[model samples]
Target: MVSPHSASDNDNENGPGVSLVEIEPGVAVVMGDRPLEALGLPAEFDCEVSPFQLMPPGDIQNLADKISLATGGLNLAAQGVHGVVSARGLVRLAPETMKAMKSGLQPLTSGGKNLGVLVGKGGKIAHQIRWVPATGAAATNVLAALGSAAVTLALQSQLASVSKKLDKNLKETQSIAHTIYGDRWYDLMGLYKNAMRAFREAQDLGVVNQHTFSLVAADLSNLEGKRGSFRDNLRRHVAALNTDQKQQLDYIRENSNQILADVQAVLVAEETWRCFHLLRTAHISCDTTMDPALKEKQLAHMVEQVKREYAQSMDEVSRITLELERMCSLIAILPGKRSISFFGSNNTRNDGEVARMAATLAKTVSEMRNRVHAIPEKPEPKVKALRRNVPDDVLVLLQYLLPEDEPLLALAEATCYGEVFSGSDVYLGITLTQFFVADKDKMSQEGIIDKMYPLADVRYVRFQEQGSPMLEMFTKTDNLSLLFNWWAASGPKLADVRRIRDLFATVMNIPEEEYRDDSLFAEAHQAFAAAKTGMKELPRKSRHSAG
Candidate 1:
């Protein structure tokens, strides 16, 4: 704080660590040797190596970004240079940078060029004495005057040459990109012409994914933003507009894609959608256990499910599968769907509405069928492509249930047991149109059990085909006294075989054996539930028996 001549004190008094050596007369290396000469730059100038703690952090960061970018570009040249060194090495030897020059020039010697400097000059000189030869005299000249105006001029000259070369080669680039991009960007582009071309080529070569696509997109965006600002500035200087000049201003932009098409908009509004949907219409088609072979285990399971519903028609199996698929699909669509169906339909039944309802149900049915058939185990080579478009949860569940071509048994034991769909007029007796009979409505699909039937004597069954049992039996078309005694004889309990078994027994004064088949579905699921181990044992013990 007190002494001017002392180095430490002088720095703090002025700017910390600032010195005459670092504090030059506002020096910068411009892009001309003549400009450098006018400035009378030393053979080497002192660059302040700011300590991270001392420097204004913002300034340091900006400088770091430029240095990093320049270093990367320089490193590209050194890759070909025989004695190429790292940025740290070049910076290390920065003081005696001339001595360190040959190493950094190695890549150029390998038939490359750099108008940029040997980075990390001091560190490079100290550690590795890379004795690389030059690619050409021009490369040597640029390195010799790096960070000075002469070096800048060399870069500028290189840039100008590059610009000219680019102008000359633009047609070739466009040709290559066109070949690569093909039809994806046929009517769209900018640098996307090049970028999308590259992306599609990568895809063709089996590399199209989010990461690579994003990086290329980011590069093109940055390049375009800069180019756009520069183009705007140039347009400001034009006093008179010629067609060619105006064309130059509009060159790339005239073909650029200004916006993405709204997918729904395109689908509903345009010809492209008809083409896409038409194309879609045409195509209609893991794990673990080292103890058993994967393929054999899977085949065995498929054979087993096939055997269970034996003698049933394929159409019946299809109906069960179709129902489960439809149900799952309805649940899937319900998550994001709300509709006008809820508004007017306090069970609405107008003909126009009914037709629309049929159409919706048809679509729902089709999607369900498609999904069931689209099982993961069963997908053929081409089915992979079509099924690739299914909803995620459906795909995940299918993968779990139908692994390795195993056939699935879509059993809906209790997914909807206690559930009820409201409204009485829903499908009380099916539908009758003037010319033909239309039948079954949405409530019927939702399990609105609507029937009953009488049996021998006073005892009878509450048949599903009957409209309502409770409303009927109370009017006592009596001799009902015998059935009340029958119910008391074999009392109902939760342990009963089937609800149907218990109900028939109650209404008919008949034993379970006489009333229903013991191997009915109700009995089978109860067996499976009780016997936690071994599916093989239960079916035998609970076999359909007559006693």
Candidate 2:
């Protein structure tokens, strides 16, 4: 313990204004008008100080020595202060050291009213001085406020990130929905709905802004509507395509079966006839009981009969096969044949598969036709075959007109038109290189000569009926136009004329725009001009009733 000393022991008779009081064995509190300043704090350090109030407790000897140095060696007890002092205590602080200490204490002083500074042995500052509030409630409230602010900021950041992710997901879902179709579309739609649900939930949770939510909702609705419309349209298109494909497939299958059966029958008949002829020839050639010349004659007769029979059988087979090939070629040209496979694997096939089957059947038909043509035939006596008597040339011409890869498809006789030239009528026929006009009704005594025209030279073909039916053809190279007039009394029927026009359009590959009749345009224009002039149209009397 240290005793109070008189002021006379120091320089001033009046003691120093600041003093130190020992609060515990090693701790003392500084009390004075300016205790912080006496403790070596800078003048710039701002803190509340009261004369009676004690400063934070610190090492007793350190506090005494600091007060003595600040007051110029005045006794602390002479100023009415009492504290135990140690000889090894620190005295003064440099300006830089005081600044560092001020900075260290600034947080404590700014925090609360209650603050404490702890010191260890040799008068060194122990950890840091902590400013604690007088009450636990105030401290708890401060901490809670700080935590709330931090949490709010973090939540906002997370929400912003989530919003961005949701926006990207919505766009991706919409793009995928547009690309997929059929039942696959439904699956994608379900996923889109799920994404929308998540977005709505996020909006409810306040993670998405109201304005952004509204915009996204509108976009999603539009996307869904477009997807629904697309699905409906696609379904209708698929249904129509499936119907057409099924019809064509059925037709091909039925005709192919019929042709196959007919060819089989012809083949069987030919084979049986061939076997019988071979047996008969062998027996006649080997028979020793018969005369050699008689045997030779019999064998020759049998061979001739066999040849004739075989030729007839082959001709029948060739005809049936050609018809089958023609049907297959027609099937190949039909539209909407590609998408038929998805209907079901059980009864439906892709266009490639169907085309392959048609090609195979056509190949078989061609081989059979070749076999028919390969048989040797004896030359007949030369005679003038009239155009009316030999219609086979017309058939040959029709065959030649078709594409090499496609079989010849015959035109019905009703679809062929006859034109009367001079006093003779010649029916038109088609060939690969030219059109042949032959007199099917008239046979000349000298012979029949058919008129021909090159097809490639023909440029424009038009069928029109102004007063009577007419067919016109213009040649590009020759620059020649040929017009055929039809008299109602002897011309082709109306149906035949229509068919002839349509066939010509198909063969010429005429566009729909070119084939359309625009002759009425001039008359309509005249009527419009008359109407604009406010003129009354006059009705012409009918030819039959005018008399």
Candidate 3:
């Protein structure tokens, strides 16, 4: 157990018999003080500090939460008061003294004025002091007096409970890792150490407040969550191996390395997620009423952190994508009957484990793909506010293009301007009755020109591949067959084109089977196959044509 007394815990006569001795970095015992006046209590109202460990666990967390909330309103450091007060003792003070203390801590109450002692307290003091207890009508005031240390103590207690579960998880996880990786276990061990270093460092700092403690707790929890996955993956791999195949050191090493790399990638993803979570929490905790400059700085920090985490997450997604592609290429070469096999069919086949790993990889990739798609399209200087793939400017225009009674279903914009189509911008809008493509540019002073095509008239949607694929909507109208190109000019990215196409299809209620791979292309493919068998020369279209 950590000692409850600090090196400076010397008793002096002038002050109360006690000095603060830290039992935890953020928690301390008040050995003695001169009199109530030195610690901000009335001169006649003498009180002694008692350890809060005697309190129930639920009460500790509740008290810590209250203290954390109260610190936002009061600053204990400015008052030159740094010792703890027991919740039990606060009620014991002389009624007059208790009244004075409550009045002093009144800022902790909603609409209460700032206490003379709390005016100078800010983030600095919020992190420094330890002892405080809140109860009764003055509970908020008392909690404020406890300082952030009370929250830290509560957090540490929570960590102790979580740690017990982690210990068991890690022991089992380590044994499985050792069994599979053999001498290579050292690599995973290093990752485990890296994961744990944060918690150890926080404990050593001896002054972790709730936010700081929360960050370390996230790390521990992430590690614990990963333990089961790692164990299951490695165990599945080993269980699928026969006695003879297990001896194939080269294959074993390769597979082991791949698993380790995957785990490391996942850890990076978890860390990124943790950062995003922290940023969100920071945003919530930020004092809107605080100094304008400080709030600006806080907001800027959060924005920068969000950008960094996004970039890191994208990098991980790319790495995972490459791995998936490679797996696909390997699967493609297998015999039809053995296509379900993973790693390979013959000697290398570990169907049970490798197939399961493939499924896991597929799930991970699907989730990452969804996240990537959910990201808002980046805006160009010329265009603005492309939120959720729909530009604000386009949505505004949608109102003018569609009938007043028509309800908008979905909207998306593509940067298909000026190449194939004479426009500075393009937008696709969908409604229950129909979908339309609107083209607008600076030269056209008149409003946007749009062609509305009924949903029932739509025959097919397909990509016309040139330098960049252009989405074409084929429609039949009263003996006329027409193709309307949803111009994906040279400017629109492949991703942008796909997003527009998918959104359009979804709003039009077109089945994925029809739009993704339309039957029209299939008919053409069959016709070409028959023509080839008859030795007829089918002219290959030019590479640069838009239509």
Candidate 4:
């Protein structure tokens, strides 16, 4: 109904050319067709002239009213003239409203003379309507506006469908992911779910330690750029990684492969991703057998990743340290050692009876200090301070170290007059403290461990009877050295009741029931058992019996 053409442009009967519909105020609709779309009209008010065309067409009457208003028509007849009906075809109306011109609105015949608008005309005498044309950029802008509106609705619907499908798939994937890979499956499975995710993390159910690897990686990038003074620090991080770190890294690789598959489907350089994959696989290939020089080079590169990973473990230890100590302390008071070990060494013996120790020694030029002591703290302060439950605990702790070579031996003997009783807590406390210092010394030496032989002549290397190696070593010496300014004199030790409760809890975790003290008696018993278990009787007695 609306076109750029004016009613009087052809009728210049007496005046200059004039616009049929002016651009000011709200657009006005007349028995003319030039103002349907105007210049500089705000985007908000366009094609939205009626919700019927923009939305679902349920209200015909409402559409008619909007059209009338859009064309500035006061009556209903002029409303229909200002609009074109698109439900069927683009039909121009006579100069009347759908309500008023309902009777005269007619169809066009195919006589080839264009009898469309004229068909409805010359019959009803109410009013006259004419087709109009718009020229210049105005027409283009209007069409674009309409197109944009239509596309918006279409895109909205399409997006809704996509969202529903994604949610369904996500749930199914997550459940299967958990069932399949435990904590790691979703992340790896996420890679294969593409319809690819833009980032691998989108599908991850795997634990992401809140460590900002970006910062650490950035540090590595800078460190590599220096390439001059990075060797020593690089070695420190490299030595930090153990077999456990490698296992975690392998799990991450599993997820990355899924990402690689997802990226290959659409990325331009599938080859580039593949090359990058090869590079990563090469990184994982590094092992103990690599050439020393090559190992060092890879270690430098690996430092970045290793640092990032180790920081996570340190964080984990910090989180559970309190809980772990509480649990371990509980077990310490239990009547028996809950866990067992069938290995080499015996855990418990008299202080002087520690006949052998499988300690390793490293001859190094103490980069940090001169003659690194077995125990970091001075024994003098501890000997002077008396503890409530663990009296002379410091002296007992010093006994784990050879103050000069046999100072701990003399101290142990002096404390008990050679009648060494088993009720002393001081020795246990000292043992853990000595372990802390020794571990620190080991680290400071860049993992150059010293195999100190206290009972160097002992029969076994590993402690037997303690079921769990972790617990066995832990009872003798915990990682208390890691704590800053740590000392037992500062507070009371764990209560006996709590200690017992915690021991039971640990047993539950290990699924073990009775406990073993790992005493000398037990070790001797195990040695005999092992000897008996491993020995075969001679054939003479057996042959006689058989005969």
Candidate 5:
């Protein structure tokens, strides 16, 4: 147990009666101030009164030591009584004055107001001296606001950085789409669409700030517009290709039919000759009175006749087979079908259909080859001069327009630009080599032509019934339609239209007879006209309707 303070503790003269001593690391006791009861301590009782350990004693002592040293031995001491410590500098006291010390007196300079300790005499603390200047509350508030602004700025910068990254990704996706071919372009388009959707979602969710969202949204809109344009262009190209394929398919089918017909004709001729020879042989063999050598000679003559007929048939078959081979080769090399799907919707034929068609063509070619092999071989005929049966004026125009190497097979003249039905008159110079559109006055005067389209680029030609009969030539390379109108007072004479159409069909390897006989071509034109009428009528209805 600790001993109690002695009565002589109050007899200090050189120093204050009270002195603070550290009881632990942070706790301190006022050793000689008073008994436990005097400092309002319970009698259950502590031997001495202690201050609360709010701060470490070493920290307070260090502050005190620094002040004493700075003030040149103006000795400062901490006083602790009943869990409270005085912040004032030490006070000098006589024996009687020590009893008047009051722990409740507020220090003249508290730590909140000043840096230095306050010096006191008796129960009162004097004014503080030798301390740092105090900062105003407004200055502190401004510093806090500045710190918050800095943090907000950092968050915004991060958001902007994220938005920039998204923009870069979108651009990269678009660039990739431009570089990719085939179906991969569609894949990249899908990715770009998804990315735009994600960006919009993020903006809606407040993951991106308004400024960043606006900038990115604008970029997305522009990119999406470009993407839409690209898709539209691609769809148009695919549709054009589909039309070309259809034309090629029709040409192949027509050629196949012709070849098959020729083959059947040759077979029929062979069978006819075989029956004739057999009957003649039977007739000769049945004559019992004829000499054996004479009968044999007659039979040999009959056999030679049959051989000649068979040889002719074989020659025709061989020519048809060669033509079939050429057609099949062209079919085999035609462009493969390309398919593009947007968001799981496909509007074009896949490659498999093209492959199947090619396979069927190949099988037909093989069948023709087998039939040709079954026929006896014949020596090829000598080359014959190709007769130029074309019109003299048309021939002259073709000769003038075409290159030297290209042979002019057929030509026709027709009025062009019949759609306008008025004003400037133009004539089209149609040949196997190229189609020339020239103004009649210009050709007769200055010799100026509007345009020349090569027949090689022409995919299909159809007769369109406009105000006048128009020959619509669909070209592959430029994806354009060329219309040639025939000049006739009575709404374009069918004879003139048929003449030009026949020439075009002959040049394009399409059978003219099919176009002449089939009503489907006329029906298709009517359907197209009806669709156009319907489209125009819809808008008119909407404009005038009460609803």
Candidate 6:
């Protein structure tokens, strides 16, 4: 063991006011009771020291022997120091090495002093070990370092826990997807998992700094984007399933909720860590600067940056939280439909009371569609498009059909010919807020009949029979039925019809299976069966009947 008191005696041999003691063969532990700078070393923590073992522990008196014996000894001790510091506590060392170190540490404790250790090749004993009895800035730096390390480790542990949760959630999602979609969604799920894989790889690199943190954040952002698309596809696919198939995949909604929760946890951890990282960098920069004026300026700039980042990060967090909440709300209400009218409501109308539609002039419908196409794409575009596209005659007629104050989202025109309407052509003009019709024979303003039912008000839609296919929508106000055959129309394609159907279903939250082509026949058959069951009598033969 060594101390400042023994330095004078060993000065001539070691160096002026320097003392070193060899506690093991070829290895020395330098102990001091004075500040490192007072014991002849730089008064800073950031400097590097040259290796000392290759040189003599003393200036002369068997210096050659000392140098030969201590060769590579400093390197081993340096490695041990690094391991202990990184571990943040005592670490198990080789039995022989521990015994030697314990012996070297023995005499230093009687004074009740704090000890600090530094290690590097080629430095004076004081350069390798510091006695930090001085208080103030040095002590604060040490404490700050310790605090930052602890917080970093805590964030890492939380992140690991969140990652494990994410893994479990991902597995659950995969199982549900396989059950519902039969492995067709595996490629889609893989896209998100691959993004997660990149995040994990970036994290595994020792020591997360600002750069690595940014990379991981970007990976998570990418995963979020992919997840959004995946969710849309999942919703559409589920909506297209039949009742029995939908029942089989009921667990999907719950699994999706779990996945979203896991993702939220990940993002919170990442953003919190990034905040801490930036603050730590700022502190380090402040501490290393020499000029007081410059340091203050640097600090003020850092504070502004930190405040800006915090605000931005909080905004991001709020956005994500709101998104997750909205998604959860949507999933919670899935597999449910709007109420159907045939169930007999107080507001139900008799067949005679149901209003019939009138046909619009062909020239009017054509002009309206052209106007719709020419509307600009922004600033209440949909509303503007509808208003600008409505022909003067149609608009004047709508005032009598709907409330003048009601808002319209869009306008569309379709030509339909059906045998049920006596093989007459029907012109259907649809708006998000209402549908107006004009029949082929009466193409005048007096012939047009408006069914001003809002899409939002529609609770259910029934598609009945292929011979004269028609859509009957039951809304809060009234039921409106349309006989449509776009195949006979020159303008709208099947895609356009589908677009309108999808828009209606989305607004009504009606499942795709409820309105699909193949399923419509079954739906119509069920409706007929229900009606037949409720019917009081069969039709009787008239005198004009051939039978």
Give the per-residue lDDT digits (tens) of candidate 5, residues 1-547: 1112222312322223233322111122232223433333222121223221212345334434442333232222222223322322211111121122222322233222222222343423222222211134422332232222212222222222323333443353333233333354444344444444443444344333333334334343444444444434433322432333235334444333333333332332233233323333433444567997787667566655655654554454444444334334333333443342211232323434433433333333323222212211221112111122333333333332333334433334444443332335555555336765555565433223456667665667786666555666655443333344434313334555566567666666434443466788899999999999999999889988956
In model 4, the worst 10-residue window by lDDT is 358-367
The parts of candidate 4 lying over 4 Å away from their true place are 1-245, 251-490, 493-547
How far residue 338's Cα lies from its native spot in candidate 5, in Å, is: 12
Model 6 vs truth, CA RMSD: 30.6
Task: List where candidate 2 sits over 4 angstroms from the true fold.
Answer: 1-253, 338-547
Q: Order the candidates by TM-score, highest first — what do you get?
A: 3, 2, 6, 5, 1, 4
| lDDT of candidate 3 over 241-262, digit per residue (tens) | 3233123222332463345344
Off by over 4 Å in 6: 1-143, 146-150, 177-192, 199-221, 224-547
Q: Model 6 misses residue 370 by how many Å?
A: 61
Please write out the lDDT profile of model 2 over residues 300-328, one tens digit for every residue.
67666655655664554454445445434
lDDT of each: 0.26, 0.37, 0.39, 0.26, 0.37, 0.36
Q: Give all TM-scores, in the order shown.
A: 0.15, 0.25, 0.25, 0.15, 0.19, 0.20
TM accuracy, model 2? 0.25
Please state the error at residue 237 of candidate 3 in Å: 20
Residue 252 error, candidate 6, Å = 13
Residue pairs in collision within model 2: none
Model 6 has an lDDT value of 0.36
Per-residue lDDT for 266 in model 5?
Answer: 32
Candidate 6, residue 408: the lDDT equals 41
Off by over 4 Å in 3: 1-185, 208-307, 310-352, 355-547
Residue 505, candidate 4: Cα error in Å is: 2.7
State the number of backbone clashes in model 1: 32
